[model samples]
Target: MLVSKSAIAAVLALSCLVLVKPQVADAQAQRARGASAAAISYEEKKRQTSDIAVTIVTSGITCTCARFAEDIRDIVNDLRPDGLRVLPVLGVGGLQTLEDVLFLKGIDMGVVDEDNLRLLKKRDPALFANIEQRVHYITRLYNNEFHVVARKEFKTFEDLKGKKVSFNLKNSQTEVTADAIFGMLKIDVERLNYDNNEAMKKLREGEIAAMIVVSGAPQSALSRFRKEDGVHFLALDERSLPNHDLGAVFDNYLRARLTHEQYPALIPEGTSVPTVANRALLVAYNWPESSPRYQRLAKFVESFFDRIYQFHDGSRHPKWKEINLAADVPGWNRFKPAADWLARHKGALQSRDGRTLADLRPAFDQFVANYTASTGKKALSPRETEKLFIDFTKFLESQVTSQSTR
Candidate 1:
């Protein structure tokens, strides 16, 4: 058959296309295999690091909780095997931390003031309706004492009524609690917002009658001031606050006393100024059991509680000694994994390093006896005894460690 030149060229091209098909397929397969290997490696790395990681939001870098979180991350994240990773994030304190944990993605937990649990609910009932179900306490970390520094003439908290008072900056944890306390008590103080440093200057200059700071005791701002400075920590007693509802106050706050040991510059030896304190809580969102977040939190919980004693040394923050791992936080259910771990360890023996509460009583009593004899201070109450015993145990541990190291 006679064929045109164009038809012959088309037939030749079709034959060439068929011959190259297998080569194209082989290259495509090679590229796909390479992609699959890379994907597998990426997934493996993700499983080791990101999958095991849990992010915990803290109030701020300087916040006690952030320091504690750093302590956790340092111990928990095992680089060799890519073990449990704790990522600490800075958050706005008080109520905001709670909201961040609830709503922000990548946040597994938060450190918050316990009072904020109620305050947030009180502020927006509908918004955080089931917050109880949504958030759970891993533990109560430390006590944030309500500090009221006033002029010597203003001897009591009530004396500051109708006076200008600094609540330690706007929407700060100090201001939040101070506002709540004053608002609840019906005290009509003119509220001012200034950082403690500036407020302290203002107080000394008589620019403000009093300044309130809610923080762990021995706070630097208060510690720097001397009793000779004409400023004092106001006592909150019935005689001082005659008409206010002390019942409501006590109900909301934990009864506490600040001693000279905590703030040597302000409080005199053998003196304990009456005060109230709220708890700093490490809280976790109630992630479902089926979720990867829950698994990561569970691993973090195990590492935290098991090595809990690491925080109790005198070398660590003095506040670290305050945390009783098995101690249940008030008004909050513990995270399930934490509760389970405690349930198993806090079993019949109640073994904390093979020493139960009963085992420590005699040692505590003797220390108290020696302390009282030397300092001429009165014996502490049951609650105070428990807190004292924690300090005593840490002291003994440090002494042992020191002797061993030597």
Candidate 2:
């Protein structure tokens, strides 16, 4: 064919595009299919199978929620209670876990922070009103420490004033907690939203002055930091600076400490960083007592409480040792089935044999009684009582360790 060089070049270019168009379209189509598959609702997936007895919506794979859920799944699998099956599904985090339990079908339970419920009530009263009645807690799980990590130069939380700080993803537990905490402190800062890994990167790169992480320690994200990284935890003190004059806001959190033992790389030996913590709750939708779902959940609750000892024997996440199935979670109502179960087995559940702080109550009361009877005076102060209880608990824990080794 007789053709000018320019015309030939143009023709070849058009031919190349024509050949590439189908490949690009095919790639896009494949991606669309994959996304659609991923987006399939949990209900639809559940309908495709008849085996799943209960599905728990937890946080990302790296979170404590995921590990706790997996442990429950394992326990259920081992016990094989009437062929019941447990499925743990990973979700966005605490906020999403709450949403999933409220709206998503096939989500029988969720792992959520107790403070999230309070936040919802404070931030969106209408929505909280609608869901609060619908949802109830199974039990209060372990505490998630509020980790405030900053460069060594920013020794105190006040030092990060007006600097960029990462609160992690919006609606995450970290973000919600940071909002409440920073609001209480009245310390203004440029708030940043990034995933855990990204926030850590920005903090290391000095793009952000500090990052708040609300998770079970040793947070894998913070664990990656080396001692030379110059990252240190900001202490949230009740008597001074960080938490001083916080008043009612302080009631939402418990005074907690992050020990060097848990994160030797980020913390110095024999020293601890004080911080606030929120308890994670195993919550469930309040299914009617007459429904099959309610019965299934009740059965699951029974099995879980019955075999909780297995979780405490170092077979699962260390946090399991801290779970107090009988502990009262302030401002939240227990699920009816769980409440009834606790009521029926009150003595056993409250006994020293269980892994709960309540186990020490009887001894504490006896000590108070004996002291008052002997001294012919008033009982010990609350502070003294707590100290004695703590000391007694430590001795009991040591005895448990000693016996287990034998």
| Number of clashing pairs per prediction, in order | 0, 0
Segments in model 1 whose C-alpha atoms lie over 4 Å from true places: 1-49, 352-406
* Local distance difference test values of all predictions, in order: 0.75, 0.76
Give the least accurate 10-residue stretch of model 1, judged by summed lDDT.
1-10
User: Residue 109 of model 1: what lDDT?
Assistant: 91
Report how far residue 108 has shifted in candidate 1, in Å. Answer: 1.8
Runs with alpha carbons beyond 4 Å of true place in candidate 2: 1-51, 78-82, 238-244, 350-406
Clash pairs detected, candidate 1: none
**TM-scores for candidates 1 onward, in order:** 0.72, 0.72
Report the CA-based lDDT of candidate 2 relative to the real structure. 0.76
Q: Report the C-alpha lDDT of model 2 over 49-142, residue by residue, as the tens digit.
A: 4443888998767788888999998876532224567789988886777988999998999999987777667667877786767889999889
